[model samples]
Target: MQLSLSDKFHSEMARLCPAPLPSVLAIMVSGGSDSLALMMLAHDWAAEMRQDPDNGPVTLIAITVDHGLRPESAAEAEGVAKIAHDLGVDHVTLQWKWDGVGNLQAAARAARYSLVQEWRRRKRPEIGAILVGHTRDDQAETFLMRLSRGSGVEGLSAMKALPLSHKAADAAGAAPVIRPILWASRADLRAALQARGMGWVDDPSNDNEDYLRVRTRKAMRDLAKIGLDVDTLTRTADHMARASVALWARAADVARDVVTEPYPGILRFDLTRLERIEEETQLRLLAHGVGCLTQAPYRPRLSSLEALAEAAYAGRGATLQGVQSFVQDDALILVRELRAVADYECPADGASAWDGRWRIKGRRLGEAVIRPLGAQSLAALELPKGLPKTAFQSYPALWAGQALVAVPYLAREGLCAPQYDPSAEFHRSILSH
Candidate 1:
């Protein structure tokens, strides 16, 4: 006989928490079977504990994140909210929307957590835990996915039941995140929901073959046909998680030894110190340092990491996607911006040509020749004829044909006008430069 929904929830809670009931808990429900089952269990558990005099009434808040990737996403969010309301729980739906280029999954996850953190700050400043529904099957799938991608120990470790807090100290306070359902299998969650007569919406994207996760899931099914035990896979993931934690600790220590924050969004490393570390340690430390500085999960490709290592050891400069690291004055500076000198020089007086590369010629104050530089000029200029010299100088240079025909400085209203002080410092600076 299958366990009842309430029994299943109580058992899971006992296994995960094993302590006095928390005063408040937040459930992340996506209207999917896994999350909905978790929410139902939490609601039942909270109700049972309400009779105890020592435990106060549990504040259960259901949070749903809408990725907005599909047309039905808004409707799904509404459904989740209605379910939470029916269950006598408060609900919040966070929409992920932004206007820049970013990894879709990572960006959505960031936005979702941001909304959760905001809600925690406003309503439950002293929340005991924020619960997520990640099942053993999901853990197995994650491990297989990472394995196929040639991932390191960290990636192979997959998700953790109790992930460390990534929030700022001010925002997180003392609340901890918990995952009671990580030990539960997907089949068990489904069985619990069936016993409760609860239903959940199936996400259509789960079946889409175009996504890497879908592909990995398919591969996992094929492997299962060959008698791969799902439980064993989960066990392997747990083992890998332990190893990953150890490796990360060492990497953090190495990073702390070499990487120093001299300013906001900048890290400085001692090249000599880095050289003394093992090559693999050096690479991991460098990547970790960059990740912390950018607050970006910057997983540099193997080739890119190798290149950076070579550059660091050779005392050369190398540019990564959003960072540049180079040895300057015996210090390795990992900078986000690198200043480059402008190659072309500005022109002087009437018509001066410097290097066949560019030409700068000035015409009569009132009758200056303006032309565009190329098929695509730097800027388009429009000037009024017979303007004051100062006003002319304020006018922007206009692009005409293939030349910069009219510059504001030489215009009738410009500061360089013949009627004005022709020997003005501005003119002299322009000429000298």
Candidate 2:
């Protein structure tokens, strides 16, 4: 198993990308066993790709993000840089100091990704994806963690090869976070590292019981006695992932037929056609609507979402995940909840986004702001022709002091405005959540 590491790496990358590109490959190496193994395998893979006359040249770059939580982090990063140098790979060390924020582990992970992505965008914009060292053990631990939280099918599903494409602003130069070693086990990776007489930095936090991941790792051995091993849990995740894909396809089909966007940030579905779909499909559509409207990273809780669905489908008003729902003339209408944006006022300076639902670009005015058109603001002006009042209350409006300057939704003729349509993005994000 140890000697087969290079073969496994080559096979996995070949399966994922049959036609290789000449772009740079940024490998995240934390001086740990898993990442060090990835670094070694990626070096060999890049060398092989370069040696091939038919294939374009491949560049391998190693990135070490020093979280600076421990005193030895900097020296460990330096060691990894030395190893990458010996292998003829370019290496960069990025320092990330925690601001004492929520969940040290989560913050560190987010910061590392952000720093590496920014570096790649500024220095190596041609790179399309960044590689990571997630293994089968990590997948099982993730499944167990989600199960502890009563996660549904989407949450329990196996992690995707490309996970960042589901986001709304993917148009930005952010590359997809790729995990090529998901097929490999942690033990095999460590054993391979030892076989090469290589030493890896072992972070003591892995044994710290304070972390849920560490605790889960400990429990895996005990659970294996009852046949609930890492392979079994990982397989369970694969099964759920299959089901998730089928459900997403069904929901996407329903959305293409019954969903329409007549106004910015508003979703109108044919009530009769929507009612004809299955309950699960309906809920999935509802989740998509709220996600598109709010641009929130996660979906609403299933129990609360079920209640909100019950009310909205019954023609009663309801709100969930910062999205409001209503029934009007045999159409189910979804809009941003007024309270969600009531106090969300940002300076009308340069180009910016509001509520993550609209992209704003207009003449910058001093002391002007972008905010929602509240009931008072809407009552003061003539409503747009054929526009529903429910959507009117949440329209993105430009204000200078107490004067209402412009409403982007109604300013289509002007050069300044925002485009919000669920019809285009609805289906792509169905399975992503």
Best by lDDT: 2
**Model 2 per-residue lDDT tens digits across residues 294-353:** 877577888877887677668787888788888777777888899999988876653455
lDDT of 1 at 2: 84
Supply candidate 1's per-residue lDDT for 242: 81
**lDDT (Cα, 0-100) at 270 in candidate 2:** 80
Q: Please give the distance, in angstroms, between residue 30's alpha carbon in candidate 2 and its true position after superposition.
A: 2.0
Off by over 4 Å in 2: 1-3, 18-22, 163-171, 270-276, 313-318, 327-331, 338-357, 360-377, 384-390, 397-409, 417-424, 427-433
Model 1, span 1-433: residue lDDT tens: 9876567667767665545666778888899999998898888888887876766778898999888888999999999999899999889887776656776656776777777877787877766678988888888887887787887766777575553333322212435567777778888788878877888888887898877778877788778877666787888888887876676666566766676655323456778888887776677766664443333433676668789878877888777755667676556766442221112233334343222112334444344333312213322334333221121221223333334554433333242222211111111111110
- Looking at model 1, residue 24 earns an lDDT score of 72
What's the lDDT for residue 381 in model 2? 72
Top-TM-score structure, candidate number: 2
Superposed Cα deviation of residue 63, candidate 2 (Å): 2.1
